[model samples]
Target: MSAKYNHWHKSRHSDPNGDCVEVAKGSGGTIGVRDSKAGTPDIVLELSRTEWAHLLTRLRNV
Candidate 1:
């Protein structure tokens, strides 16, 4: 599962010591998303590049 993404990084606005989300570049034009807090189950969500951009846009508008 770890091999699915190259590298994972949280957003710049993320709290360093609190629950955070991480994203990584996946194979092809995919994006990988997961939670980085301790004790959280290792779950990953894969999205296409277009879907990722759309999600970001919607988030920014909220």
Candidate 2:
């Protein structure tokens, strides 16, 4: 079955002008990110399960 994902929340550090990145996730192992402003393409940066975990760990330390 295809798991569903949707934009949950906007970033707290988002631009005051409503120009920010929207993020979502799927059950499989992918993150969906896109620009909040109109007229922009959705940027889907796919990562392997292992890669995702490593990335998360690195980000937490940042």
Candidate 3:
């Protein structure tokens, strides 16, 4: 993913030891997710807004 995201935030329920995911809003309304413990230059998973919403819904139901 591009390095142009203005902000990236960790989940409010993230583990205190830093094992969690970070998410950011990117260009063209895409969402980016990456491993918080992976350090910089990690692989980012990009998803469309619809995909993100669907994922959250599925996760909540789980």
Candidate 4:
């Protein structure tokens, strides 16, 4: 969402071309992900803490 409301963090490895996404911890321990290139406050994905951990584990395995 908006930066004023959500503190979004981008990957440290992201390139200058803006090919990346931002993530933030939301209320009730939910996680929000959004496109870094998009200026609008649009959350592309939302996951619970456990779901986020599972996704990261799966991604690391790949």
Query: In terms of TM-score, which candidate is strongest?
Result: 3
TM-score on alpha carbons, each prediction: 0.77, 0.53, 0.83, 0.75
Using lDDT as the measure, what is the rank order of every candidate, best first?
Answer: 3, 1, 4, 2
- lDDT string for model 2 (1-62, tens) is 24455654577779988787666676776665556675654445555567768877998899
lDDT of 4 by residue, 8-57 (tens): 88877788987777888886567888777777766457787899999999
lDDT of 1: 0.80
- Least accurate stretch of 10 residues (summed lDDT) in model 4? 1-10
List where candidate 1 sits over 4 angstroms from the true fold. Answer: 1-3, 38-41
Q: Rank the candidates by TM-score, best first.
A: 3, 1, 4, 2
TM-score, predicted candidate 1 vs. hidden true structure: 0.77
What lDDT does each candidate get?
Answer: 0.80, 0.64, 0.83, 0.76
lDDT of 2 at 4: 50
Reference-based TM-score, model 2: 0.53
**Runs off by more than 4 Å, candidate 4:** 1-5
Candidate 3: give the clashing pairs. none
How many residue pairs clash per model?
0, 0, 0, 0
Candidate 2's C-alpha runs over 4 A off are 1-4, 48-53, 60-62
